[model samples]
Target chain A: ADTGAMAAARTRQAQLTKPLGALGDLEDISVRLAGVFGSDRPHPHGVAVLVAAGDHGVAAGPHPVSAYPPEVTPAMVANFLADTPAGLGGAAVNAIARSVGARVYVMDAGVNADLPPHPALVRAADLGAGGRRGTSDLRTGAAMSRDEAEALILAGAALARQAVQDGTDLIVPGEMGIGNTTPAAALTARLLGQDAAAVTGRGTGVDDATLERKVAAVRAALARGGSDPADPLGVLADLGGFEIAAMLGMMLQAAALGRAVILDGFVEGSAALLGVALAPALADFLFAAGECAEVGHAAQLAHLNLKPMFRLGLRLGEGTGGVLAAPMLLAAAATLREMQTFAEAGVPGGGA
Target chain B: ADTGAMAAARTRQAQLTKPLGALGDLEDISVRLAGVFGSDRPHPHGVAVLVAAGDHGVAAGPHPVSAYPPEVTPAMVANFLADTPAGLGGAAVNAIARSVGARVYVMDAGVNADLPPHPALVRAADLGAGGRRGTSDLRTGAAMSRDEAEALILAGAALARQAVQDGTDLIVPGEMGIGNTTPAAALTARLLGQDAAAVTGRGTGVDDATLERKVAAVRAALARGGSDPADPLGVLADLGGFEIAAMLGMMLQAAALGRAVILDGFVEGSAALLGVALAPALADFLFAAGECAEVGHAAQLAHLNLKPMFRLGLRLGEGTGGVLAAPMLLAAAATLREMQTFAEAGVPGGGA
Candidate 1:
């Protein structure tokens, strides 16, 4: 982030036509945008919602961790890419992204099935050598090799870099992995040094029995995975899903490139935890979209110290929450760049 | 509210691609919107933000209740109508409204000075016979006569009815009265039977000394005003500002016309309290935009049982908070009306 640009933005905010600090978070957001864009006037030409899709190996056992079948992952991936009558894609994220004028990009991190080629789907080949056909069961061993994890992260970073080069200024990192929250809980618990039972939540509206199973899965994954908090990549390879690793990469790269990234729900926040672990400064580039209904999301946000933009109890995680918050960033940037100062408007009593 | 339509909306929400209740407040918003529009699919054609501006005589004394001078009221009224280079108006509300595709209508319910006419300005004559040039000191006497109070509400209702007739499906009631919070706190304290100090806040960032004075002003106003909660009109006439009365009318008429109304900040919520006092059913049509910085807003919302859409700490009360929330209503309606259902998308396992 450009400290000079941020300072300039803060100065400009005081001169805007509202009482000092009256705009609150809106003022903070615009200043952050200025830092990210390194310009006094930050205007995003393109907004992109990246829905990373993969399968969770822990969800495949007889006693599954998720309420929905693992098959739903690939099915939802197809749903996300499918065009609807509204001209938006077939999913909730697509509708919201369309409403906010954001384009949705479906990333095939490592889904189990071979999805037919689609224009919107970014396949493993595009993600580079780290991408593979999902992962082995995390309950037994590491989810992926360290090399593969590194490659996946690199692939995700490359995607974000390309999007920025293509004029996309804001990136919303979302995930679509059935039973992914099991890994997210495990990751957060391990990173924050908290109990798995405390971090675990019922994903996709699981019953009490299923929730217990999910909690056990998170505990098992943590026990088997590397425990070193410093080795984020090693920990990620052990317990993280392909999409989670990819999202971590996307956050890191987006921040390095001076672009904005909005994180959706628990799965995305887990990815952000790893991103922040790898590069503490990555936290500066990230925005928590909302306080989702997921139990661990609040804990994760508290750990990151990132105040969510809204709290609509959203638990759906295909960039829906992130896309919904994208407009706020737009409103912030517009207000900062366009609103007249008290002197310019010939109004007495300046905001300062 | 159309109960059948609300039920249909609830049912349809379960069928959407996400899990049951995963959308949280968004689902509730869509259902309520269906109830208000009397359709399972409620698409709004126009979103109008009514910013009612008035002066407060209580701000004219030696120890003013507000940080800004009372003259700032009419100046802001002009500011709200001034054109900016971005094609939006000159104020915070205008920038936010323009970003969300909502039209801003400045209502001069009572300005202390003579104002030139503009296309966006709704003059006093248009507000009916109850409209006057500001309000007297509530600490000394009644803010307006009971007749004026009733007439102002009727005029506000007429404007709301006309807007609905002109294809507006959403209405946002905002206010711009310097020292307005003083009157608002007094009215709330009287209606809710609470201490004046408990409800009074630092309006527009008052200093410690000014805050003391403001609280004292509220206490004096309430002591002189009517205390009966049953006679809402009398209470309003005794302590409410012109903008607050007009906003109360807007809420009543908007609800009656089946158009959704978003409440801005503390001043707007105070008006909403009066509206709900008059017609308890009006609660169904109102949405609290955000948790404003005012100390009394939460108390007002708690009384109304309305959950704010967001909490960006906004206190600039020219419909800015309300305008920012209009987009969420749009997104909610679009998701309900456009997203493909689980069954329609050929995905397995129903939400039930």
Candidate 2:
């Protein structure tokens, strides 16, 4: 974070008509935004949401995130492409993004099923139109090869760079997969050096029995090899999903380009854990859109030392949390960018 | 809360989808909406936001919330009436309400200046069309006569009842006044039986010297007596502002009509403390729009034993906090009201 920009923003915040620190996270948000973008009260120049869709072999595991069939992944992706009303997650993201004037890009980083070509879709350039057919079951072996992982990551980085070049100020990263949380928990546990039970959670809502099985799966995945935190590619290849690696790559690229990235939820956090291992300074460019309902997410956020902007009980993935925050970030930016200062408004302003 | 409605809602929640409590406060919110509107999935039938505008003599006190002059109140009120580009609490409320399909009502509970005549302004029938100029200085004595306080309460009650009759499912009560937090702080301390120092905060943004003076003024008001919590009306006459009293009436009436009310911030909370003394069950009908940016709000909320709906560090009270949450509440209600149940969606659903 640029300390000079932050200092300037803090001074500007004090000059606003409201009390010092009265806007709460909004005040911090504007200040951090200033630091990240190197401008006092930095608003998004343009907004884009990247939804990374993939598949996980863990859906075939004993306990899946939900009872929905694995086909739901491709079905929801198709619906998102058509802007159809799917209750899973895509519809909410589409509606919220439209409401906030954000462009939506659905990427098939890796999916087991074929998704029809759409203008909004991003696919493997070398592998042709269809997405890389995601990762295999983590319970058996590495989800992907190191080469495939690197390729998918570079693809994500390319997308992030493109968005920044197109004058996109903020990047919202989300994920959609049948049993993605399984690898997410395993990855979080590996990176944080914690027990699987602490990191595992009911993904779409499960009973105690399914939750137990899910934890056991994470424990099983850890017992497998190539789970070392020091080796970023090893972690991605061994246990992480293609969508996670891709989004992680995007986060790193966004940070490198000095573009602010607002996180979606636990899946994003899981990717971020790997992103942090790869680049510790990535934390400076990130903001939590909202608190995730997933239990491990709070721990993940704490590990990252990030304060989420709001706690809306939003467990939905697909950048919906980030979409909810676009208006607020704009409002925070507007407070400094548009609104008159106390002196400007001729309102008596006093502060400590 | 209606125990039967809550019970029914809880049972429905278990069967609908998600985990035992995956939705967090959203689960509680749905259940409470059930209690208020008497349905398992009580979505808002309609929405109305009442912005109560008033003036205070405390603006001229030793410590002012801001350096802005008193004339800014009526000037901004006129700006709000004209839908001008003043970025105070009113414009934020207007934009947020327009974003959602919520109707907005600007009422002149009391402003000291001669507010211009506007079609949207609500004034006492007896006081005629131009609107009521507000109370005397609280530094010397009562802000308004007991009769006027009662009249203001009745006026607020009438507005709430009218909104409910007009098919308004949710009521958002917000207030605007310079140095209003001073009286709000005094009323909170009086009702919660706390010290002035504990309850006082810098309203609209005041310097340390002004904050100290504000605290001393609150202490002096307490010393003037008539602050017994048991006598809610006496407390109102001694410490509360006109907008606070009116909002209190509105809350009480809304509760009586089995309607849900979302509170703005500290001013609303202060009014609610007295309302709780009048009718303890009013807590069930109320949802905090956001955590007030004011320091004294936590104590008031704790005293009421009500968890706020959201925490946006929103100290600007023009129903803006509630406006931000309108979308969330609708989404929560829609989740149960519109989405297919797990069994219906052909998904696995289990809860303990």
Candidate 3:
């Protein structure tokens, strides 16, 4: 963030039509964009939604919290790619993306099932195959070796770099992984050093009995794979899924390229927390889309010192929240770029 | 509201790709739109922002709480009409309206000074002038006589009806009344039976001394103009501005026409509260755009059993919040209209 640009944006906001600071978070949003873009005025363009899809290893277990079977992951990815009649996630992402002229790309980081090729689809293993058949069972062992984790992270970084180089100014990081929140809860609990019951939530509308199972699964995963706060990659390899690791990689790489990343709900928040642990500066480049329906979302947001733009309690994470937020963010940037100052408008009150 | 359509929409929501209720308010928003449109799928179109602009006579009083002179109201109205250079409010409203294919219309319902005519400009005085110089001081006497109030309200209703007849599918109600929160706070306190200190907030970023003065203004207004919960029209004549009264009329008439109304922050919330007092069913047709920075907004929303869409702490009242929210609402509606169901998409195991 450029201090000169930020100061200029703030002074400009004070002189806008409304009273100083009357626009509240909307003003903050525009100023932040100006600082990031290093300009007195900034414009939003070349937006992209990156739906990082994968399947959680824990879903293979008989006692799963997910209402839908893990096979739904690959199917949804295919659904997003075809976008023919679109699914709920695809419908939302596509509609908002079209409204803001953003292109949608569905990335298969590590889904367990076979997926057909499509123009808007990319394989995460193009970075390197983190694993061929999803990840290892976190309840018993490491989800992936450190090398696999590194490869996945590097692949995500490479993808982020490619997008920025291709003229993508903003990245909305989203995910689709059945039973993924189980690992997410595990990762969150480990990184924050808390108990599983405190962070576990109803993933995919699970019953109370299933929620308890999820809590226990998270505890078992952490207990089996000891985590260290100093090593984010080690923790990710222990309790994280490919999609989560990939999202973290994207944030870090996007931040490095000075491209904004809108973090979706809880699933993406977990990846961001992990990314922050790896590189705290990544927070400067990230925007929280909304308060998610997941129970642990509040804790994660508070820990990250993030004020979410909206609070819709959205938990369906195909980057839907991020996509929904993109237009408003664009409006903020547009306000900075297009709104004439009182002086420029030659209105009687040239605000001091 | 269409009960059958709402019920059908809820049932269909469970069949979407994500878990039940994962979409939260977005789901509720779309369902309500479905009910209003009498369809399982609702689409937003021909959306226009009705900025109810007015001036408060109390602003001409000594020790007024308004930061800027009352003349800023008419100037801002003119700014909204000429969007080339764009004021802050104009820039935000226009950019967002354009993003979602909505048109911007500025209404000089009762600005104190003269405003120029434009293609998208309309004055309620075309219904018949309510007063020569905006509204009278509510702290001294009734803001307008029964006849003036009736004419203003009727004009609002007429405008709303004309828009619906002219193919408008949605109305975003906003306000631009300098020192108007004084009356809004008074109306809110009266309707909710609260005290001035409780409901009065810093309208447009007033300082501590000004906020205290605003509280006193509300107290004085309520004292001078006795209010009756049953007599909503009389209350408006006593304590509401022509703009606020007009907004209430627009909502009631638009609700009757089965058009969706997106209520902006506190000022619009106050008008909607008065509308609900007049007709409880009006609550069924309204959607809250965001949580306001004003102190009484939560109380106002609570009394109406309304859940706002976002919590951005926005206080700017130019239909800015509604225009910002329009994209998300469209995405929600498009979700219902375009998304394929779990069964329709086929590769799924729908949970029981």
Candidate 4:
């Protein structure tokens, strides 16, 4: 948490062979990471990706134009692990992770159906006591209890620490929650002090009419929960999904362990908003990988004053954007660590 | 040239792992090279960087905000090769060339000073001459004679062929002409079918009042040459530098030899415009490396329909931007060579 460490890391980064600030934001991230770890030679290892999956209760009612049935969450999660045909899970993430040497793990924070036990699936649900198949209706009900939110956070943090303790130096937290954009929108609206309509956007490609319905559904949920701006966490508990809660926890825990965390798109950005509010110091440890083209994401990032690493107009969740951005992160880290310094190269300085 | 060969190369590029268009403009360059060479595995070798040095006659008079005296051109070229205290030439270029595994060649196209004989210095004075020096009067003056322009082009092409025969697969042409911006502006105006005011800008930080004078100088040159927008080569001969002429020839020769050419910023972009104009087929061989902040650069690029490799707000004219961009080119080539295809990775297709 010492600011001096961050400053020192920045100094070391500037000293690298190349023009000052030539590498752009990557240089800033590398320096900050080095400072947090208090090492000039900060080796990024034990890189793992956390993909949290959950189903949104808002998706239960077919408003029309919603991509598929709510049951798709479990189906896709299964496909993600087994590499099945119906799944959007594998491939992109697999290639990107393999390229950057990051192990991928899927966390079942909340799903509609009972998932079969699998090694790749980590059960980290946050259903309150007397919890049934799902929590009370999030549309007109509380999304998750405070204790449940804390549990999700703890689970994410624990997983990150375990990865670090197991020799992972970098962690990319991603999510695959169906219709979770509703919760992300609600959370973004509350945190950024904007109306639900201002931050609400279509999830999984809905028509204008369905988009209006989704917006109304979010508004109804916000009104049902009293949408108190003072209690931002309450707003999240009232509308946040299991995966987002998990991401919030994961980011905080990763930062607490001094590992670099790459935040992906809107869902991840919402989680970052929460993480930043909870522990302001974690903001220094977080890197905005890329922004989603979703309406609410830009507002969330603007609230954080964060610039995305890349902008390829990607909207697919499940950490695909984060995975794609990993190569750039690797390049930045490598350049920072390996590039010869101007002093080392004997280039004339401003002093000359 | 067989269009089918280019198409095949594009197909091969698309087949390389990563996203189909994730590599952006780089994919196009590599594929074009592959098509030109008629080889699936086109290995770039015998890469040469031509650093053309010249003195602008216009800089001899008092100009507002000139960085150094006009004599600095030859002196800098000398310092570029020699390891003097004030020298920036040798080290930066050497470091970049070493980084990309390319060879560096300095060409004394039209330096104002008499020089000691050196192997690195190609004494092609007639081919490297600058426009009328020391005066803003460009009405009756020509930057280079028709014979000089032809000789420079021939020399450049010869140099490129020699490099290609020496096993180089790429060539980056650089320039070091002081006050060359005057001529560069005139060439840009002619190529883009715009008046000099549309393309003229503060080169190397000329003040507001002085920039007005520079614009006037460019307009005078354009009028004096009676520059025809349809005739780009004639415009270059009338108002271009020896380095620009040589670059045009080098690019044409590189294209003829089936080697890829990486165009630098505005100065090189001007050269590329001339090259493509001289041999329309050469347009297929050049890659614009970066979008410069120069006044006429974007217009010229738009005229050529070329997208720069990067946008770092660089305007340093000593081939630094081109050198910096080499890494991206190499990265693109490596990606094409190493990325796994969807079939190879056992990933599903988008049902194309």
- Winning model by lDDT: 1
Model 3 whole-model lDDT (C-alpha atoms) = 0.80
Q: Which 10 successive residues of model 3 chain B have the least lDDT summed?
A: B83-92
After the best TM-score superposition of candidate 1, give how far the Cα of residue B339 lies from its true spot, in angstroms.
2.0
TM-score, first chain, each model:
0.97, 0.93, 0.94, 0.90
In candidate 3, what are the lDDT values of residues B1-352, reduced to their tens digit?
Answer: 9999999998888787667787888899889999999999786677877777888888886787877778778878777766574332354566566655676766778888867767777789887756446788888888877787778778788888778877787888878888888888888898999999999998877779988888877888888756686798888888888888888878999999999888888889889988898888999888888888889999998988888888887887888888777777777887777766778666486555
Q: Give a tens-digit lDDT track for model 3, residues A1-352.
A: 7779989999888776667776788788888888778887887577888888888778887887687788888878866765464332344566556655666777788888777767677787766855455887788888888887787788778778878877888898878889889888988898888789988888677888888888888888877756687898899989898888788888888888888888788889889889999889787778878888888888898888878898887878888888888877777887777766676555554552
**For this target, which candidate reaches the highest TM-score against the unseen true structure?**
1
Better structure of 2 and 4 per DockQ? 2
Report lDDT (CA) for all predictions: 0.85, 0.75, 0.80, 0.66
Ranking by DockQ: 1, 3, 2, 4
Over A1-352, each residue of candidate 2 has an lDDT whose tens digit, in order, gives 7889899888988876555666677678778888888888565568888888888887764456554556667766765665334332334466556545677777888887766777777775543323557677788788888887888788788777777887788898877887888899999998888899998887877678878878888888899866688897798889888888889888999999898888988999999888888898999888887888887998899988888777867776887787667666665665555444556544443433
Q: What share of the true interface contacts does each candidate keep?
A: 0.73, 0.22, 0.56, 0.00
Clashing pairs in 2: A347-B67, A347-B68, A348-B66, A348-B67, A348-B68, A349-B67, A350-B206, A350-B207, A351-B207
lDDT of 2 by residue, B1-352 (tens): 7789889888876765344555567667778888887877666767788888788877764456554556666655654455335332334566456545577777788877666677778775433222347667677788777787888898888888878888887888877777788889889888877889988886666778878888987888788885577899888988888888879988999899988888778888889998989888998888876777788988987887777765767777777777667665655555455444445443333333
The TM-scores of all predictions, comma-separated, are 0.96, 0.80, 0.94, 0.70
Name the docking class for model 3: medium
TM-score of chain B of 4: 0.88
iRMS values in order, in angstroms?
A: 1.3, 4.9, 2.8, 8.2
Give lDDT: candidate 1, residue B144.
86
Instruction: State which candidate has the highest DockQ.
Output: 1
lDDT of 1 by residue, A26-68 (tens): 9999998898889877886678988888887888868888878
